[model samples]
Target chain A: AQSVTQPDIHITVSEGASLELRCNYSYGATPYLFWYVQSPGQGLQLLLKYFSGDTLVQGIKGFEAEFKRSQSSFNLRKPSVHWSDAAEYFCAVGAQDYGQNFVFGPGTRLSVLP
Target chain B: DAMVIQNPRYQVTQFGKPVTLSCSQTLNHNVMYWYQQKSSQAPKLLFHYYDKDFNNEADTPDNFQSRRPNTSFCFLDIRSPGLGDAAMYLCATDQGGGNQPQHFGDGTRLSIL
Candidate 1:
């Protein structure tokens, strides 16, 4: 079974500071990676996704993720985070098969100190 | 325009009483999914419907049931609400699989009393 691991359970950063969230996955075949952000009392919004080709994928809200095949990692990064960026971020992996089963990580809570 | 809609953003039900949460999609996606998310935990997939075919997760409790009457609507039914079932129920739709980003509704926050 494919699984995703997010090492940090909670992280706090000051506003205007750079941020990086770590994510690692374990899958047999080439993996499809995705990042989702969930705000308080709201549904999840897609941040970015890496299916194939380029290792670096850009997403909405000035967020980006890089797919590292060797490290089995797809980390989300933002040059500068705003107060609104504070939310729960999840990393997920999808199977290459037809079923396209997607497994989610435990998620990391990001806190921005203004 | 909101692509996905989940009714009764907050619901309170007595224990052992059956409650239904509705989700409707305007995207006309082929796959619709129900996910249960508790505080400080990942969202767990309860079940999904691909067209008319139903796929329930292996560990999903029989107490929780789902119905997809057509392409536009899906419902989650809790036969017996328990304290453990008090959580946010999220409804999402996708074209086929994870390759496409799944659109999500605001979700229904279920409370068991």
Candidate 2:
């Protein structure tokens, strides 16, 4: 079985500061990874996904993540955080085949301080 | 825009009462999933419908049932609500294939009293 671990439960950063959220996964093979963001009282929105291509995948809202096979990590990063970027972020891993469900992390809550 | 739609943004039901949540997708994806997300927790998959075939999670309680009459619509039915069942129920849709992104609706917040 595959699982995801997000070490940080909550993080606070100042506006305009660079931010990185760590994500680690345990999968037997190369896994499909994704980043999702959810605001309070809102459903999750996909940030980006990694299948099989460039290790660095760019997502909506100026977010990006790099798939590092050696470390089994796909950390989400943003160059400059905005106040609107405060939300909960989740890291998920999916199998390469069909009919399989994605395993999601517990999620990291981000707070942007001005 | 074509998207997944979940009805009743908020629901309040009494304990032991039966409740049903509806989800419809304009994207017409072949797969629809129901997930339960409690406060400060990740969304846990309850079940999913692939086309018309239903797939329930191994640990999903029997009280939770689902119906998918067609590809575009799915329903999550709880036979008897408990306090533990009070959580946000999210509906998502995805193409029934590898590497496809799942789209989610805003979700229905269920409150069991």
Candidate 3:
């Protein structure tokens, strides 16, 4: 079964501080990985995705993620986080097949302190 | 601009009552999906429509049904919404069947009374 795991359940960071959220996955083959952000009462917004080629991918809102094959990890990072960046982040894995089978990990709640 | 849009941003219903949520997309994507997301948890795939074909997740309950009248519109109907069904219902669209990035709507928060 393909599954994703985000180790941190909740994280608190000071505004303008660096942030890193770890994600790990288990799949039979190379899977498509993605990061999504969700604010209160809003749907998810795609942050970035890793299909192939470049292991490091940049996304909107000054976010980037590195997909490490050996560690089966796709960790999200930002040089600095803003107060508005406080939200729920999710890591998802999908098999490259006919039917859409996207599996999302338990979200990590991020809280930014000014 | 919002590509995917879900109506009734907030919906409240009585237990065991039937309720329907609607989603529309301007992307004209071939695939549409419905997901259930509870508080403090990840979103779970309920079903999806690839064109006119319908695909339901194996673990999805019988109470949950979906309809895609056309390429641009889709509906999710819960025959008997339980208290546990009180959660955010998200609708997403993609270009094709496989590994494509999806565009999500603001979602409808369904509250069961």
Best candidate, DockQ-wise?
2
| Model 2 residue pairs with clashes | none
Q: In model 2, which runs have C-alpha deviations exceeding 4 angstroms? A: none
Question: After aligning candidate 3 to the native by TM-score, how far in Å is the CA of B5 from where it should be?
Answer: 0.5
Q: What is the descending DockQ order? A: 2, 3, 1
- Candidate 2 chain A: worst-modelled 10 consecutive residues by lDDT: A94-103
Tens-digit per-residue lDDT, B45-98, candidate 1? 999999999999999999999999999999999999999999999999988855
Model 2 chain B: ten consecutive residues of lowest lDDT: B94-103
User: Which digits, one per residue and each the tens of the lDDT, describe model 2 over residues B35-56?
Assistant: 9999999999999888988899
Model 3, B55-94: lDDT tens digits are: 9899999999999999989999999999999999999998
List candidate 3 stretches off by more than 4 Å. Answer: none
lDDT (CA) for every model shown?
0.94, 0.94, 0.94
For model 3, name the residue pairs that clash.
none
After superposing candidate 1 on the true structure, give the runs of residues whose Cα lies further than 4 Å from its correct spot: none
